[model samples]
Target: MSKIQKIKGFSDLFSPESTVHTLMENLARQVFGTYGCQEVRVPILEKTELFARSIGEETDVVQKEMYTFADRKGRSLTMRPEATAGVLRAFIESGQCGAEGTTKLFACGPMFRYERPQKGRLRQFHQLDVEVLGTDAPQADAEVVLMLWTFLTKLGLKNLGLELNSLGCPECRPVFHQRLRDFLATIDHTQLCEDCKRRAQTNPLRVLDCKVPACKSLVENAPSIAESLCPGCDEHFAQVRDILDSAKLPYRLNDRLVRGLDYYQRTTFEVVSGEIGAQTAVAGGGRYDGLIKQLGGPDLPGIGFACGMERLALLYGQAQIPAPDFYLAVLDSRALNTALLLAQRMRERGFSGEVSFEARSIKAQMRQANKLGVKTCLILGQDEMEKGQIVVKDMATGVQKNIGQDDLEQALGFRKP
Candidate 1:
């Protein structure tokens, strides 16, 4: 016999976990909608080139974390390791940018990233992503960050820290990069990781993101690139700061806070919490002003952020999602048909309920309902069925009452009893 087990880095979501996901999705959607962001669902898979071009090819996500494979026709494909690239691909592919004014879209979906699984990190996790396209104003950057901060605050995640930085537009970034490299030269290379050593020669900016204790200590006093921003980038960063002040959201400026993507330009920020270990970036995003044009779309600037739902859920405490309020259990063969019809009607009328499909005895059915945490159980037995009525039993109070079929909704407190 073979051992049955879930694959490493993956686990199942059953019952309350599934309920929690639904509630989170709905809550995020509601919040995004309130801010005039419409929901969009993108495919879970995309051409491998999409990410390679959008997220830097040198980044760990594309080089180490992406789940890529070849399909029957020998075309290389990959599950979307993140949502922003896929969202950008959709905007271009669907000609959404050409539609009209700005495009404000939100997406909630499963994102794939291969990494060592931990408490809040999973191989198959979810992200709530928000993107605004067709603007390059610093105000747009501020609004998006402000919106995210407000949203997270509303979710009761009060302990998060906002780290902000500006990567500067292409023309000014090279100057900062040279200065950064010069400063890094003073540090010993022996203390850095092999990857950081290699990155130093290639993508030197990423060397600052090193997590090793020795490397962290070495780079602690490194010069801030945000302080070196040229006139244009300087004004942009200032305006973003002004907006944050206006919104009364406190933030720490970190010059080394560059996003691990080449396409990202100008403003970049991350919302992190120390509650989780090293990968504490609960949400991160920034302005990718050149990304739209780079991806074969119109010359529109875009800004957005992606929040890891797993991390947020963990930090906020995973209160069990509520179960259905009522479970309608029918007894006797004659009542089964009516129970099925009633179950459908109850749901259609905005009631969370279920009816037994099997011919279980009344006691067994009631037991199942109690196990489900149902507060109210609808009983359909021989006497009630013959009298064209049902019994509404309050499981909590152990009170029962006979009500006609038409009064069922009213009995459940849909209206005055």
Candidate 2:
């Protein structure tokens, strides 16, 4: 029989990759929590209608990428391809929609999509999502972006630039939509990707977001929605920019950042890194002022962004294995349980390390300790067990000493938990 293999475009995360993932999540909690944003978790699977309603039906994510199917009862279900829709559903169902103050939430987890995977893009990828709901104020937009920027900087990511754009609102988008439609109509059929071709009819703005180089070129001269913003929409976007400017958060205006979602309106932004090849976006989001109402909640506003963890790990390089404080090596089968108990006691005292699962030769155990980069090694042998003493070796200095069992904590320097 052959060993089973992982599915294509999906991957197993272990070692340094898992370490980096952990670091990102820890940093997310630390930084997002500092901004008064509470952490929340949502189901990975949801009713397919949520996505179809949140992300437009014609968008690439819904039409091609989502992992959707009918359940045993025949009700259509889908694994979430993105975080926002599910987060919003949780927010609405929790009845926080009628709350007076703005609600801020952050989530971290895997999302599923059926698209072709590549560097930094996978079928099952993780995201650090941050969202702010119940406020349409431009400060909310600026705050969310600033919060995202702060978190990325805290993670030690460099060479990143923030791009800002406004997709206008329902009032002005129709006119820009028509103008964009007109320009897309003039492009020859050969120049556009199939996805962009469909977008040209369903949402011409998405055609501008096409990843195909040829497709992007064909729509390069398409009318910019920024130039067509309604007075209110224009004002909201301007204030967001002004706030960003006031905070010394350097940003560039990209008239073409109509993110590939239909829920966005007014302000949109992305933090891009040159370090990551062609797919520059490590994070992106915008204001969805009408989504709450559309989802049967109070007519409120929300804005958020998701950081792609895979791309971030690429920028940060490999993660280091944190060294254990000690390694307990057992040289007698009778001492196995005692070594485990001692290691447990060490842990209870706030020291972290590992213990041998079975008795082994001193040399073999030392080799294992060295491989794990443990700084100290405690030897458990028949003689030491009988004498009620433990052999403690300083791995760094290559020195050894026998200490009475009662003095082990004092000699090993255990700390209070």
Candidate 3:
């Protein structure tokens, strides 16, 4: 028999790493709630057509990265590479669009993709997704961006930069597409990377997002999308900028920041950190006004963003294991029940405590308490039980004190409930 191992590109989060994940999710729940956003739980697996239609057939996610397969019934299914598409599907199927004019939702869960794994980039990763549906106003775009900025700052991420761009709308994108295609035609196709070459013919805008050094240089002098925007898109982009500026949110206007997704339109933004190499974007999203309607839903506009939890964890520095409020050590097997009851009382009083489950010597129990880094330990033994009292030891200072059983909660600095 062989020992089982975790699949490549998949990871097991343990100890302090799992603790950091919990802290991030808790903070997101609070911050997103403050902004009037409610939680939405979507499935991890969705129909293949959902992503194919929403994310576009030609995008890298659909062509290469997506974990797609055929089910037993010969129905094509895919594990979601992103959350927005499934969220919109749920909104439509649940009839939330008719009930609630606008929906503000936040979701946190694992998303799967089949890409080569690297630092901060995993095949199975998690995201904190936020979306505001049923609005076309640029203020919604600005508000979503602002909410992301506030969330990141609250997470103790510092020295972050916001990069903004506009990909124009259906009415104006054709003009820019033709101009970009003409420029690419002039350059020898052989000089470009294979992906960029394919993208130039299929979706010229994606070439701007290519990271290849050669493709990047070629795109540096490519026609700017800002210059080709029609009046509607231009005004929309300007208003988004004005709102961000009025709020004193500093951002750089990068005309080339065409996000990888095919759904983005009008306003696109990414929050970046220099601490992470190469993959600098910690969070990115934009206005996808037509996404809901495109996915067989009502004509509802939506804007949202998603931050890679792994990338955020990478920048979170060292993980700090949380200390327990108390550790209950039992010296004699006969006093186990008493120790458990006391520990439960402490927990109900809002103190986190752990009771010894195994019958161990006093010294061994003390060692376990120290290993857990608990601040205080309540020692329960036959002697203490007979006297109707307990021994309290402060792990930090090695101080010992005796307290009546009834006064245990007060001695631990907890008010009686």
Candidate 4:
């Protein structure tokens, strides 16, 4: 039989690729923690209705991209394409998503989407998600956006820009939809892509988000949502902008920044980078005020965003892992037990390195140290053990010194005994 290969769109991440992903996750914890955001983990699969109701049924994500299947009992389940829906579903089920106190939570995990894999996008992808629940205050929107900005800035990524927009709430959005629909009537249907044609009939606002050149050109002079914001929405959006300005955070107000998700309302934003090729969006999210109640939870509001880990890895450049401080070489079978003890002692005191598991010749052991790029080597031989000492060699200069076993810590310069 032939050897088995990994799935087409799935990847086996190792070393530096997995390294950067870990660093990004840790930084998210550090930065989000500073802002009072706690971590939460939710299942990757859920009832299909969870997405259909949360993300609009007409949206492409629910209509085309979800990895949905049936269980033995015939109940439909879907691999999550995004994180916010599952995050909220957990809080709702646990009774924490309510009008009590503001809950700032973050989670990072794999998200599955059945779309064609692109440069930084995959059929199976991972996302670092952050969400703020239980408050509809405009300040919540600014806070979450600012928090996301802080996390990305900490990543040392360059050439990144934030795009901001306000998708008017239920109050004034209906009017804009009607205006957009009328504009579509004047254009020839053949000019729009099949997806946009369906979007125009089902969810007119999505037509504005179509990336097709033809559809984009047609919507160029179409109605702008800014022109239809109700007084409440306009003021809410203005407050969000003013707060971002006060924080000295620079952003561009892209009239077309409506995110792909349907739950977004009032404030929508995306962080794009020129470093990542065609798929430039490194992260994007917006406020979803009605999603909680709409999804059978308390009538709470939420704002959140997800940083695409794959795209972020592309932006983070290469990940570097520093070599160990030293290596322990056991040259004689009689010294094996002693070498293990020395290795354990050094590690307990915060020193790190590799130790030979079995007795090996000096030539072979030193070669292992050289391959690891370690600067110092500690040799434990039968003679050295009998003398109650460990030989330390400087790999670079080929200089050697003998130190008392008790003096190993001082020899390594870790700290005082």
Candidate 5:
């Protein structure tokens, strides 16, 4: 028989690392709630067409990265490569868009993609996603961006760089698309990467986001989206900027920062950290005004963002687990029941406690207690039980005291207020 191993690009989180993961999720829940966003759970798998339509069939996510397959019924299904499309699908199918108020939802879970995994990129990864539906106000865009910024900074990530851009809405984007196409026609097609070349024929805006050195150099002098924005889009972008500025948030205008999604329009932004090399974008999101309607929902606009949980764990470092309040050592086998009862009582009273189950020597039990880093230890043995008392030892100070069995609660200061 062969030993089983974890598949490539997938990993198991253990100990302190898992603890940090919980901390990250808990913090996100608390912070996202403060922004009036409620939790929404969506399935990991959905109809393959959901992504093909929302993420655009021409984009890299749908073209090459999605983990798509056929079900037993020969129906196409795909493990979601991102959260936004799945979220929108749920919103439309559940009729949340028909509700009166704007829907602010947040979700966190694993997203699967088939791309080659690298340092911060994984085939199976996690994201902290937030979305706001039924609003076209630029303030909604600014608020979502600010919340993402606040969430990252609160996680101890420092020196973040904020980049902002706007992809004109449908009315004006077509004109810019033609202008961009015209410019690409003048350049030698051989200089562009294969992916860039295909994107040029399908979605020209994506060419500006190409990471290839040659393709990047070619687009350096390409026309800017700012000049082609319709008056409505231009005003929306200005207002988003003004709001960000009013809040004293600093950001740079990056004309080349067209996010790798087809739904974004009007306002787009990314928060990056230099600590993570090329995958510096710790979080990114933008407005998707047509997604809700496109997905068979009411005509409503939406904005949202997603942060890579793996990259967050890498930069968050290891978090320290707090020490237990008490460690109960069974110095005698006869006292085992008493120690277990006392530990349970302590826990019920809101004090964390642990008990040793093995019939080890007193010295061995004490050594284990020290390793647990407990503040104090309750030593129970035949001798102490005979006196109707328990031995309480302060691990840090090495001080010992004898307390009546009934007085254990008082001695530990756990006697309810």
Candidate 6:
């Protein structure tokens, strides 16, 4: 038989690692809810054109990274390579933007991209996405940045730095793009990749995102859009920084940090961690004032950000590791029915418990309890059933108490624990 293996650049998220996923997502939901942001769930598959238009057709995500395929009906579709485009599409298609006048939305789900996997970068990843629509003020920009930092700090992420920049609005970007194109023209075309070479002619701003050593060298000296920001753009950037400062959040200016997508505009920033690996930017986002209009909706200004749930999970402390409160041990075949009844009753009483159907010995069941790291075990066997009593053992203290059926739930601390 041939060997079985996962697809290249993909991984299995199982067992304890899966617990981390739940923990991070729960914490993010709690934090998001506190800030008046409601949760949203979007589909994983979308029409290919949604991305082709929302994310730039010339960008890497559209040109190379997308997992696109034609369905049996001959309609082209793609898995969501990123969350922002799909979120925006949902906003326009649902008419939520029009009815609500503003939508403060948060979403957490898997995102797919066909790229080489590395330490923190994966072919399939999970992200916590936050988006706000119908707000153009600099206050909206700072609010999202401040909320992200607050959430990270609350999670005990230390020394997380904020890197900020503004790619300027539509009216002023063309002039700067011309200057950027002019600067790239002088560089040796032979040294750059075909994609970067093509980007030079089609969308020159994206060249800065290239990691190639020679290209990075050429682009390092290139003029930043920040320097050429029109008066309005400059004021807006300054105001955003001032708002962040007023909130007592520390940040550093990064002139060349334009996002990979074309929809992003003024006020881009990332919450970075040195501990997490090179793709350590746990969260990043920016304003997209024209995206709503571009997607065939009314002119609406929006800003948002997304954080990698997998990376955040890796950083959670020991306190976040959850343990089942109770383990229901069915000693042998005779006690199986009793164990099941007790476990179900415990659930109804708002307590958590797990039962094993393996028909293991008392010693083996106790070992499983210890391995699961739970404190209390409700041990049911023929002897205890014959006496109409159940033995509750404290795994940590090795203490045992025999309680009758009438007081079983109360004695086990089902309602309290």
Range of the 10 consecutive residues with the lowest summed lDDT in candidate 2: 408-417
lDDT of 6 by residue, 83-198 (tens): 98888888888878777556789998989999888877788999999998898888888899988987888777786788999999888899889999999989998999888899
Q: Write the per-residue lDDT of candidate 3 for residues 144-211, one digit (tens) a residue.
A: 99999999999998889999999999899999999999999888788799888899999999999998
As a whole number from 0 to 100, the lDDT of residue 317 in candidate 1 is 71
- Candidate 6's displacement at residue 10, Å, is 2.1
Candidate 6 has an lDDT of 0.85
Cα lDDT computed for each candidate against the true fold: 0.86, 0.89, 0.91, 0.91, 0.89, 0.85
| Count of residue pairs whose backbone atoms collide, per candidate | 0, 0, 0, 0, 0, 0
- Candidate 6 ranges with C-alpha deviation above 4 Å: 1-3, 317-320
Off by over 4 Å in 5: 413-417
Model 3 misplacement above 4 A: none
lDDT of 1 by residue, 274-379 (tens): 9988688999999998888777888889999988888887777766756786898877777889889988888887788788876678789889988888888998
Taking all chains together, the TM-score of candidate 2 against the true structure is: 0.97
- Give every collision pair in model 2: none
lDDT of 2 by residue, 66-130 (tens): 99999999999999999999999999999887789989999999999998788889999999999
What C-alpha RMSD separates each model from the true structure? 2.4, 1.3, 1.5, 1.6, 1.5, 2.0
Pick out the ten consecutive residues of candidate 4 with the lowest summed lDDT: 408-417
Regions of candidate 1 where Cα sits further than 4 Å from its true position: 1-4, 358-363, 403-406
